[model samples]
Target: MVLQSNVRPGLTQGLIALMAAACGFAVANVYLNQTLLVDIAGTFGAAEAEAGIVTTLTQVGYALGNLLIVPLGDIFERRRLILALLGVVSLSLVSAALSGSLTWLIVSNFCLGLTTVIPQIIVPLAAGMADERNRGKVLGTVAIGLVCGILGARLVSGLVDSLWGWRSMYWISFGCMLLLALLIRLRFPVSKGTASLPYRRLLLSLGPLFMKEDVLRRSCLSQGMIFGSFSVFFTTIGFLLQAPPYSYSSAVVGLVGLVGIGGAIATPIIGRVIDRKGASFANKMCMLAALISFLIAVTAGHWLPALILAAFLLTVGTQANQVACQANIFSLSASARSRLNGLYMVCTFLGGALGSYLGVWAWTRWHWTGVCICGMVMIAAGMSAALGTKNGGNSHKR
Candidate 1:
């Protein structure tokens, strides 16, 4: 077993927990608008199709931020950059809350997405600071916050919209962002190990880095596929739950986010596995679990418990696979940690967008069974890519 001592020692569980909470807080901004589209449309007197632009612009901003801003972590002081971005996020949220027109809301949401790269920065920082012995565990712990934010934002936004109206959600998140910025300034340690490369060079380096690294390429594709499949399930589950035998309400659909906790809780446990058995073990299980979950979901359409179990399994697999892939990615280039991470995120988000689009299309055409089939195919594709990489190993990186 080899341990890499890369950064100065100061990481603690308390700091880890705060970092996790901050990440959850920051990343939640991307999703807050998802559940509020209807109310927003009503308030602005916009059509449903026009209102959909809010989510579209948010997603675009997120992708652009991942590509453009995240790599700056390797150039600037990470904590300072984070604090600055938190300020941007706070301003964006407030602007969103006070938006007077659809156009203002759209631009504000885009800015909100652009600056919410804090979680991405924090993840690589956690990996860069920890040795292989504890890297997976730290990343996993932080992922709990990231994953929770990803799954829980819709619930929070939906609840707040019901209670006070859509704008209130932004106001709450806005206040929370300010508090997180303060706590981060006070508690998070400064880590700036990257060379003083020019910003253009820093950005340019990502291209060759992505093209040249076998491990990174593999990590991106494998996780991208799994996340794509994960997206498929979440994207279409509400439709399934609302129709036919289980005709549940939208609130009940929101409760389904709770099922995703299976993955959140399993993340650290999976990290332990990556530590003891290597990340490959977790990666393998990720593909397998995803494949199995889809099979179960396909047959269990009429049974609520079965569908819930399928959702749980799908989340566990995707989350575990992601943690393992990311643990490996962070190890690949200590100095390039943020760049690698940013690229990984960009790929996976693209995959998720693809899955969301495809899933909706499948549901529109063939309903539940079609959605399950599409998810299964994506997971299978990931598994196939993994198998072709090496003998007895898709996690050929570690």
Candidate 2:
């Protein structure tokens, strides 16, 4: 595993934990708005459907960042790029907290998403630093933080909103980003980028890179669809829980995220399975889990326990599938990992943006039933794409 001359030593368990923490803190910013959509809409006297745009725009900004900013990881010093983005995201969170109108909040949230792509940057950095023999295990450990941040964002935001107000959550997140930046500055080692390509060519390379890599294409499609379903579930679940048959408080909705810990606990084990059984097998298993989750959710409209069970399964599926897909793509190119990651994330978040929009659309019409059906359709499509691929036998070779 050759690396750039200035690349730091291989990951320590402590460094891996810090990378995981950074990924968690940075990625949490993108999701803080999910559970707060209802409170935000009420505060601004906007319709639920109108407020849904906040989630969609955040995802759109993330997708754009993956396209425009993440590829820079290949050209610039990664720690510097990461810390700079953290500073911008901190300011964005403050802007969100101080937003005077829904429009203002929406714009600020988009900025937050645009700058909150530190997790994506960190993943490639970690992957590059890890030993090939245990790369899956390292990635899975880091993914635990990613998973926790994503699910924990809902839990934290919901409680903060319930106790203080929706805006308070942003204030807390702002402080978190500031603290995260300082820790990263102290703890992370400097690693120069491998690629020295001109900026324009760096961006242009994404097209050819995507076109040339079969594993990259399949991984993108499978993960995009699964993440789309993930977006659909989280985006609308709060609204459903707050309505009839449940009439739950925001705090209760947040607690549902805690229930997802069952899934988080399984990620390391999935990583080991990927190491032993291969990413293709893990991908298929994850898709099946996701499909069954939606199937159960379709009948969970009136049952809290069933809903909880479904959420757990969905979390496991989405998080495991992410590990599998990322492991698959990162194995393809040592030098182009960042660019490949950028293309892959761009598609994944585009799917998320679409899911956020579609989830709201379905909720406004057919409610929870509609959201479940949308999720099922996405998982089914992802399964079809994964099954169509012929890479299953060779996926473990790397």
Candidate 3:
């Protein structure tokens, strides 16, 4: 029988609330650029495809920050790092709000993404706090908030843009970051460990985990490919909806993301399945579900309800696989948890960053058919990666 870690810890309710708040606000930064891309393009006198870079550059910043900033949680006071990150994100949001040029807006957006590492920090922190038996459930709750923040950002940004303009979205984000920073500073516990390690070595050590560990490699690669597929759908859907007989407004296109609400709701259910049945089973199901969504997306053009259902299925796959990856990693070791999460997320975000650019480029050059094919191909790649790992045995191998 496996020895479960502490099933219950004496952590406070206040800390849990603060963690959820931090995740909610932090994830909003990743997607704030999505709903506003068209408006930003118009404001900057830029092409739509070029404006798509706003999302890509922000994700690029996130990928880099994951590599550089998240490992510091193991060596620094997690609370201090979290607060500082929120401060940087707030300032970046303000800069984005005040930008007079497209170049400046994109730069500020990149900074915002870099500093949004607050959620990443909080996830490891939450895992370190919860007991093994309750780990998936606790983390699932926070993950729910993270997914909600991501989904909600697009919805609110679009709705706000409809009412007050796109600039208002940044201003509102600035306020949310500011308030969450204060709450976190006052409520969350400070975590200080491994402070003696040199920062450079701390970052360098994560490389070996990939080289020696198959489970870690597969986890990172699976997430990377899954997110790549997700980015392909979202990045181009705006153009698709605005063009055809649908010809939806930015608000309508953004509202389409509400489909992810089902994924958020399914997190606890997926967590339970992983806790009882194991991650391998859960991972396989997620990969197959995502592949089906790709097929649905490819063949169901101009059918609003079918396309919406496909979007929901795609998000469900992404979130389930994400939960499996987290559970697999956190179950491995307590000491290296932060570094492990940092390494895994950097790869995943890099996948997302590539997908954003690739999706936009495909749409521009080859149209929606090309973009759909790209999404299908990425999902198939993810399924193949999952198949390669099925008989590898144990979540710790990768």
Candidate 4:
């Protein structure tokens, strides 16, 4: 079946920005707990390593949701699916805010992840609607929203936690999700399903999709590794900052997310690069930026400036690499975009879950040095995947 957009002949700037904002707001729920990990640990009288499980479990749930729920986008009306997910996530945030114990919070957060698949669904929707000429740029615009939500979650959560408490952050997120759901209902066009396959067939197709598409495979492997490294740095950085020489507060540590705004600002330009120079070229450059980020992060234990610089580079790398990979896979099959996205993101967040675990584990045993080693190894593995793929001449043709 041929997919169609009912909105208008071309996507307007206002609508694009709205979609971007929606993506940012939806994805922020997943990372809100990162900056508050230290405070959460103190609240529950649990070790920091134990507190880190909140982040790990959230990613694991996200991966599972991507695998199981995101594929439904292709079989159901997208606007309804997205709104239903938003409602579920809002309830999860409330559950998180009211948690009386760490175990309760962990379970709430996992539920939060399970319902937070809205952004993944929206991304493919936007990509499918865009013309090939502007697909990369549009994807980048949406990516900017996703990146900001990710980085901004830390900043907002930290500030809210410092001002009120960690629980207050969840309350704020719940409000934000409700507001976003209202906006989506009012503003988003009704987009119908593109495929006629049964739910079971949709689920069954994902494995063959992964096995059949080379671009999908490479994009998944490389982006998954980079996302793992991205998770490693973020999951443990709060712990590092709250202790040791700097001894900064959660709010102060969250300022590091502001540094990442530089990366977000650069995403559209990277999107254009992917459009002109191809995903292969952009992928290589992004991997190099990540490599440098971790190298600088090794010195972050003693120097504040190094940590800030590393954060900026890593954000640029991960965000840009995502735009590249999405641009590559969305080009493969219009009818299968959501399924392709689901498969790609399942791998990406699984990598993130592993990185979250390793980040805490490394921090517990080897300290900052160990964390840096783990991040570098993940980046190296990603680089190997990108280097191994034969360069596609242009991403639009992929």
lDDT of 3 at 256: 93
* Clashing residue pairs found in predicted model 4: none
Sorted by lDDT (best first), the order is 4, 2, 3, 1
Task: Estimate the lDDT of model 2.
Answer: 0.88
For each candidate, give its TM-score against the true structure.
0.89, 0.96, 0.94, 0.96
What digit string (tens of lDDT, one per residue) describes model 4 on residues 1-398?
Answer: 12323333546676788888998988898999999999999999999989999999999999999999999999899999999999899999999999999999999999999889988999998887788877888888888899889999999999999999999999999999889988989878888889999999999999888999988888888999999999999998888888878788999978876688777877888888877878777888999999999999996546888888999999999999999888888888889889999999999999999999999999999989999999999999989878876565345643
What are the RMSDs of all candidates, in order? 3.7, 3.0, 3.3, 3.0
Candidate 1: which pairs clash? none
Extract clashing residue pairs from model 3. Answer: 214-397, 214-398, 215-397, 215-398, 216-398
In candidate 3, position 217 carries an lDDT of: 81
TM-score, cand. 4: 0.96
Model 2: residues with Cα > 4 Å off, grouped in runs:
1-9, 391-398
Error of 3 at 79 (Å): 0.8
Q: Residue-pair clashes per candidate, as listed?
A: 0, 0, 5, 0
Clash total of candidate 3: 5
Can you write out model 2's per-residue Cα lDDT over 1-398, one digit (the tens) per residue? 34323224656777888888888878888898999999999999999999999999999999999999999999899999998998899899989999999999999989988888898999999888877766778888899999899989999999999999999999999889889988999989897889999999999999999999888888899999999999999999999899987888898899986788677777888888888888888888999999999888997656888888999999999998998888889988889888999999999999999999999999999998999999999988889878865555444544
